[model samples]
Target: MLNRKIATSTAAVALLLTWSAGLTPAHAAPSSPAPTAAGWLARQLVDGERLETVVDQVPYPDQGATADAVLAFAAAGVAQDNATKATDWLARPQTLAAYLGDGTTESYAGAHAKLALVAQVQGRDPRSFGGVDLISRLTALQAPSGRFSDKSAYGDYSNGITQSLAVIALERHGTAPEAAVDYLVDAACQDGGFPLYLEQTPCASDADTTGYAAQALLASGRQAEAARALEWLEGVQGPGGGFRGSGPTPQENANSTGLAAQALRVGGRTAAADKAVAFLKSLQVGCGDAARAGAIAYDATGFDQGNATRATTQGITGIVGVGLLELSAHGEATAPASDCPITTTTTTTTTTAVPATTTTAGTSTSSEPAAAAPVTSNGTRQLARTGFEPGPALALGVLLIATGVLALLLARPRRAER
Candidate 1:
């Protein structure tokens, strides 16, 4: 009787163990949601629209007005690669001054910088429009500690908007300004993200600040540091294939995503770069009127009703143009036809001008015209263009590293508590 009772108990225990094993699979964690194209599309629309509005309203000239018209046309030409139109616009001094005069000193400086970029691309001397002087003023705006202060009192230091603008100015003027990078790096928090300025800073790194920082650094020639900042950026990307400005908000906005993608691409993260491109494409509303299509609206579905501005227009144009350029360079985007011109307008004149000399790393090269020459270093060639550079990237990277280390250290105690 005892042996029989023991056998039954053993069988009962085996049955219970089998039942528990069966329940384990059901209690397992849920799988991560797959990334959706729609989510990416939504982010693009918001960013595209905001960018479009900014580009549209910045007071481009009426068609017949020589000066403003020229600037207006030039601005449009840069977007569309219309060299003929750009030249026509540049041919008129009054229009140029009018367009250049629309903003305060800061905005004018930005306009000149943009013009200088277009000139650089067309193999023209950027200094013709007082580009160097403009850069100097932009640089002068920088505080002794390397931080930039907007002349406007209402400007928020935390946004780092002026600094970003300064980065563009410095880049177009053909030199990487280290002061901005130093200031930004000094202000970096313990996290891989930057606070707007240095106070009332966001809890997590902001997408806008991070994106701008990444651009500045990459343009300045600090690839390794840019890569580090990008790695930190990777952590901020939402599952939706878009990044949030901060916190739990997952609104997939365009400005952040567009800028972020550009930064990642410049930093050499091909996969993430592809994802960002896909996201931007998903946001495209197809070519239509400024109100209907050219404007990058709030969602891929096209619901936002905001007015267009020059800033958005330039941002979109730069992203699409530069993004395509980068992709084409890597053979990811289609190669342009031999007859295809990067600029949209046709040139009426064929002037083979003398080449200007340039000094890089204290070494001067005189093989080609300054406009047509390529500055090569470490297997990377840079055309004289108004963009971000490596100095900011290095500074941003230093900050990111410091922030990441702090985050890890702080996380240790939390894990221990748990």
Candidate 2:
């Protein structure tokens, strides 16, 4: 059970113009003349009035992406009605909370955390959304080391996001997260950007994990660490003001740029944030395809060769600097992390503990975590997470923003979409 009280204090939604004022960098990046992201997104709704992965693929609404779209609307101060519909779709029991990973303890940690944050920003009960208690479920999945993923899934897929989203969701519920920040702090690469998992050795850092980790630390009030991370993360930005995905590929894209942009904005790097926003805007699908005009692309070529649904929704998050840390600023006193450990531990002898096991979000255990799924050789495995392909590919898939980057790199869209 969640050792916290869910809060429901409603604040009048602010207009989009000033939505990012608080997070705007001291040195704003070069601004651009762009369409209203919220209004553009609002036009892509399907007949059900909910945001779909592609409006044609999967047919059903994407709960996680829908939550992201709602938060984006809230951030932009437009399309409250459509945002409301997306929220309603997520709040349905048969949707995000109920169907993702089919109730697995680990599979949908990111989705649940993000959905709870949507409720948090709306001043609703994230714990009792559609009779599903996301806070409690997320809390129950914490591992002994304070990580949130199970071992059975792919690499850092669940843990990194679990840590990031948990900080925000639990705060809205008025309960301090019991997981120690040490796990995320330890996950940082030498460059200060965090990896998909924890590590002690030198490894390359990634924008996605680094962005989420920075946001998680900020929401948790670990400002010093957040500051250091923001610096290292800024180093990865390319000349075009975009950040790269995890791995050997230094290519810039919306998902990574969005994540890094949100992190930089909240962490007090306005110039970096502004530049990232500009880069993402340049990726929006425009003029050519009327059906996808307002949608965001995964990367430069995505507009011509990729699907826009997931990338567009997530892209809006970075563009507006929408995050739980920002939301926490509006509510009453934010929830602090609990002192006692929140992860579960079984009785095992010290000797047997040598080959000791560690658990992840889905209750799956691993013999050796490859010494944490950092940017080492094991890093490649981090890109193979199953379920919910995101990014450039337009596949008929379910939900999992464990970042769509992995999907973009590994899977090709097999089915054709309208």
Q: Pick the candidate with the highest TM-score.
A: 2
Q: Estimate candidate 2's alpha-carbon lDDT, on a 0 to 1 scale.
A: 0.58
For model 2 the TM-score comes to 0.63
Q: Per model, how many backbone clashes are there?
A: 43, 8
Give TM-scores for every candidate, taking all chains together and pairing residue i with residue i. Answer: 0.49, 0.63
How do the residues 156-199 of candidate 1 rate in per-residue lDDT, one tens digit apiece?
23245345545654665566567766665655556666554454
Q: How would you encode candidate 2's per-residue C-alpha lDDT over 220-267 as one tens digit per residue? A: 778888998899888878887888886654678778888899888888
lDDT of 2 at 306: 29
lDDT of 1 at 129: 46
Off by over 4 Å in 1: 1-126, 130-132, 153-159, 198-204, 246-250, 286-295, 300-418
Judge candidate 1 against the unseen true structure and give its global Cα lDDT, from 0 to 1: 0.42
Off by over 4 Å in 2: 1-35, 54-60, 97-107, 150-157, 198-202, 248-250, 285-292, 302-306, 328-418
